[model samples]
Target: MVATRAQLIWIPSSGVGHLVSAVEIAKLLVERDDRLSITLLVLNPPRASKSNPFAELLASVSSSTASAAKSQIRFQELPYEDDPSGLGAKSNMSLAERHKPQVRAAVAELTRALDSPPLAGFIIDMFCTPMIDVANEFGVPSYMFFTCSAAFLGFMFHVLALQDDEGKDLSEFKDSDAKLDIPTLVNPLPAKVFPTVVLDEEHRVWFLGAARRFRETKGIVINSFEKLEPNALKSLLGDDKIPPVYPVGPILNLEVTGRSDKSSEILSWLDAQPSSSVVFLCFGSVGSFHDDQVNQIAHGLEKSGHRFLLSLRRPPPTGMLRAYPEEYENLAKVLPEGFLERTSERGKVIGWAPQVEVLAHPSVGGFVTHCGWNSTLESLWFGVPIAAWPLYAEQQFNAFMMVVEHGMAVEVKMDYRNDLGMETKEIVDSEVIEKAVQKLMKADGHDEKKEKVRQMSERSREALAEGDSSHLAIGRFIGDVFKNIP
Candidate 1:
């Protein structure tokens, strides 16, 4: 074969899930062999200091796990202003039409930063397809990473097509049972469970613009295994509008360093607990909570009497937690009286967590999640039953897949509504949250969900082993997409 020559750039969307998934793929490229040189282009949040905690953590993790491929992996940070809210800052102001301009500006700045050298290809996040035109201008291939499963992809793409052809909007489909005739989907999902991007009419219109841009990518890669979504994979491969679909996943398994010492400490705590006794709660990197919702959630967890771990941030105004409306002490006062005292011994409320390590802990029998794809995979990898609470993006679809289709999770909200404020818009009350957590830990039918996840964990592990399907796909990607360029 010709000597390989390629340089790959990864531009991830905002959120830990996307970043983790992208990093894992980058690691895979380097681990396959030495000929691959990769540039990891991460945008710096305008407000965060040079010593950003998440970035530092990522650097540390990458350094440890990437020894074999260290020299080949390069890190570059570009100043990005995705929103003027100054990274990690949440605002109640709605700027629907204006959001695109800032996104385009960020992409332009990224493209301008890449002016020095031409590479064989660029791997952009699915949400960053505005960079496709830039990739084309530079005569480079732009592969799109969906950052989700094949079934979820099918649902999203199908919704986009409907908007293009039929002018269908979420308002028309809300709470309605419509048969989505997409191939490989196998079943029709309730529109309520679709991504919030297509939830409202204006949002649906906005999505069409983004979807149009996303469709321009040269190829699409998903973080999913073939056995998990075979039919959806087939549909993606069959679609003439898109390039071939590669199901290479359970991406976390690619890590060689495993969990850190702090992570192990938490795991140790879990190990001492009874099997299936702990409930692990984690929203995505960005949090969305209101004060009332937070109080209610706290009360619900306390009442349930289950040992829990709550990873939370202040939600937006009319937000989930009381932290936004009052002083820290005042916010603390909002929890049900005596709730903290009673549960303090059984609870850990850390600001951040080593999620994968926690999930893999034997004591962690259940997960309360925002239903983000990476979290879903991590939980599945550990055979942890999920209590699904989808907030934004493709989370709703993921929740549906886990709870409804796959039967590996339970939906926290059966009748939740969020027509009021951004923070509370999709909020499920704490009572439901409590019930879901209980069900996940121990319920009449929970064994079935637990068993399914256990089975999924086995498959996830198998897919990452040598000569396995995901492993083979990674090798192929290196050959076709990354290797032999210059």
Candidate 2:
């Protein structure tokens, strides 16, 4: 029953979040159409070097699919320049400038890498528009995947249109005070609501390239349920000139089945606590904290008087994260003196936990997050309230939406970033965190808000359902965009 159709190649950028979402999309595409064979184009470094997660995951998925007799999904590992992991090398520049050139290179290289088996179309990460141009070069249609809200996408596009082609400066952005046309953004937004990259000249130009490249594509695919970003979605695609848009979202449900081993341990700890007594803290994959900010956060969490599970990635050289000072890294020492001991039976600190599984758990009630789009959708999907601590970019905008517009979360308004390093200022103290946690845990007047989330979740599900808006959009894309293009 293997019907041969045009091949679709998915080019997902590196990072845990992007990689996971890309896999989910690929899996869904294959599930919907057995005739659609997919080849995930993963970029890996040399053979001797540590295998990048992108390549490793692709290999694992390929092996698992084959063993399960679902051998239609395939993987191709593209070599990187110099080292297998240019992660460190890529980090040398600000995120705004790092990937444009690499994307351009990957385009030419990827085409050559797949010389014999012609690619039918491409589904590329929003940031990797250079590949879209490559698709155009070969007379193939390309689709853009915005792994965040249409609100974020609109903001990026507006900023790009405002900037000059050279992108050497952003004088126009600094003084402007107007809300961009993002759907459902009830709060009046200022120009500063966009990411820092949009405000800087260099970053502005780099992002412009990606957006421009996107416009050249056949359509856009978003990793959001239509209900979650209604206003933003309408603003971007409601216009006839914007090309097609498909909202196939909250894709976590597709691949997620149960808790992982680490998540189970965290859930067990949460189970012992009273209902809604815990605050689940997880910044996205790469959020870093200064020692001073970390100390203050520790102080605030301790003061909150709630059961807590705080997950940290590679900790820093000193303070709570330092491994050599293992004894001091214990909750009591790392936090205020009496704080951890008082809540000892209630709190736990783990490196990483199963985020979605933990979020869906009944014991968990609130989230302290970095405001990444995926995390935003997950929190809303699970009906968890939030304490937002935005570190960078549109995170500030997301915090505004959660606290001001949606009334789903409270923003922790402490200015931690400045040229002089993070000021030792603590805006909302532990008592404040504790109070917010209490209100969120309680039924209070939040039932209406909960209903809003529930309704949105339903809409999200509907969008991805067969013959629904997103499904129809994808179907239209296959018939209209990809079918006759070649």
Candidate 3:
């Protein structure tokens, strides 16, 4: 029987990245199936930015679509009446503990709001697996949305499966200089390039909890494509510990909404440059530098003699990860003496640039990026190679995946750690930054690398089109819901 209507609720972990990624896949899901509707039930997170990612998603969902199916998408933010987990006040609670009460509250509220058409399934990021049990209370199937690459997900599951006698835990491996034998990876991963979670005991425990909880979900959805990580996806499926895995990704390449008015100067500057001559620098949302480091980066850009646009901000506040908008300051005060004047014609320094517009421009030949997954995919989508400078979290691992696994980027600093809002032991020298910029921008050594990335760019676009692997995987997932979700 044809289903009259079906609703799916997707709960992303509390962050701009998680929310935006969920919105991407949820939009595609509804577009492919007219019988489907999705509701993004967001829990309140602590900090807010002027360029909030959720606002961008909301705008796109409301206005940018050319299809009639866009109306099937719905959005709601559930306000927690009682602080069952005290998530409102910032504490050191694990992510699982932090999301439980809010997830239950959202579920309860949504249940009460619906009259006839009930939920089909709940889609959640791996960080919010605590919400899976809430789905059981309503007899709804829960699915896992793995936001990271398949290689990282496979390595994590391998670590979680290892027993006391099998090998030492990830924390013990931290002190050693050994490369892990993750069977899923094409090359062994060095301990220095591992994600930040395994290095800390508390975060390691939290990861283990999330990893083990995957087995309880109905299925898993990864934000990656088949040709991108074939072997790792194969390994993920071969393992009995994980549920049926679906590869549906390169999702962050969707249309960006809510770009600020400040981007016009940057885009106009880029358009005036010769095609494939300018390089753009955009670290992740929170990636910024200390004054000395910013000085070094400025010196480097001046020496490169290439047209460039850089998106930079002041450092984040104490005990916070995301940065808030700062009062406008003089560029000369933060950079080296005569730096702005020396490169004034070739370089434009803005407080924040519209990253999607800059990346899409024909003049942008390369990117100097912090290899957050979103930035990495965006560069690939635009066929712009990167000089990878990873700061924290799984970003170091992402850098490895880009340089070693995909050969799409050059490595600048895969092991740089300067995110405690403090001074670093040693600053990356001006010459080092200059060399990497030149290599990615105008060097003859990167032609083959650029060609390969261009090929992958075609693949990235094809994966989301009709009759492609990612599109088919999403279709199959919807079919599974129709078959199993009662």
Best by TM-score: 3
Candidates ranked, most accurate by lDDT first: 3, 1, 2
The residue-by-residue lDDT of candidate 3 on 319-431, one tens digit each, is 45544434237877988888778888888888876787888999998999888887778888888888999886688888988888778788788777654332236788889
**Runs off by more than 4 Å, candidate 1:** 48-54, 65-68, 80-82, 85-118, 167-171, 174-181, 253-268, 316-331, 414-431, 443-446, 482-486
Model 3 clash pairs are: none
Please report how far candidate 1 places residue 53 from its true position, in Å.
Answer: 4.8
Every model: Cα RMSD to truth:
5.1, 5.4, 3.1
The weakest ten consecutive residues by lDDT in model 3 span 84-93
Q: How do the residues 44-149 of candidate 1 rate in per-residue lDDT, one tens digit apiece?
A: 4433332235566567656764575666776665554444443321211112122334434544454466432336677877666665665666577778887878
The TM-scores of all predictions, comma-separated, are 0.83, 0.80, 0.91
- The alpha-carbon root-mean-square deviation between model 1 and the true structure, to one decimal in Å, is 5.1
- Total clashing pairs for each candidate: 15, 5, 0
Candidate 2, residues 1-486, lDDT tens digits: the string is 222465677777654567677777777776766656666666533232222234545565566555543755766655554432223212222221333455446545645864323456878876566666556666678887778776777766665555545453455655467555444365666664555555555445555667666677778888775666677788887666465777777776333444468767877787787776678888765454544455666776666666788875543233221111111234344455575566578788776557887787788877888787788888877777777776554576777777667666766652222111222244545555566555555556446655565666667667777877767665665665335436
Task: Note the Cα lDDT for every prediction shown.
Answer: 0.66, 0.61, 0.76
